[model samples]
Target: MAKRQPRDTLPTHIAQWRDQVRRDYGIEDAPGLILLEQAALALHRAEQARELLAKDGLVTRDRFDQPKPHPAAVIARDAEASFRAALRDLQLDVEPARPVGRPPGV
Candidate 1:
């Protein structure tokens, strides 16, 4: 018989991501939960991108044509961007992604 890999465990990145929700955010509320959900989604997306990119950038192909711009890459990138935007919007003076420009009137 051959040894089989363990299937009762999550991937490394997925484990870390799930662990993040265990942090104490002082007050437990819907907003906090929402943040965690958003973070998880972002992490998932980034992981997808990493996996796709690691595959020699070939992604997928068919007998007729090959997809350009990398479909997975686009999805992952968009998910990451959406996550960042959502996180920024949920800002309660926490890690705000500052815009590099003059504030309205220069």
Candidate 2:
């Protein structure tokens, strides 16, 4: 009998599946690129939110009172909190926030 791979190797399998989907769906060029770009943007925003929360310890309304905050900051904060909560529920290691001395340019 062949040895089975660990579940941790599933990501490679999933990527192959996604590649098959792209081929089967005939995904190419502009529209496909746009979708891929959007996915990348979403992932970038999620990472930003995660970092913000991890640095600031909490999202406060005051954070929005700054001279300029991207309009998406609030949405990002909410999403980050939800993600963290979900991680906690799943018994995953939730990264605790590290205190940042002061707001930027303060």
For lDDT, the strongest prediction is 1
- Write one digit per residue (lDDT tens) for candidate 2, span 1-106: 9998763222344446445645665657676644533433444456666677667655344555745454357768665556455434434344767777986787
Tens digit of lDDT per residue, candidate 1, span 1-106? 9999764344677657545543544425677666656666676777777787777484566556865556777877887887677556555344657898888877
State the lDDT at 102 in candidate 2: 89
lDDT at 96 for candidate 1? 56
Per-prediction backbone clash count: 0, 0
* Model 1, TM vs. native: 0.54
Clashing pairs in 2: none
Candidate 1 lDDT score relative to the true structure: 0.64
Q: Indicate the residue-level lDDT of 29 in model 2.
A: 67
Assess every candidate by TM-score: 0.54, 0.36
lDDT of 2 at 21: 45
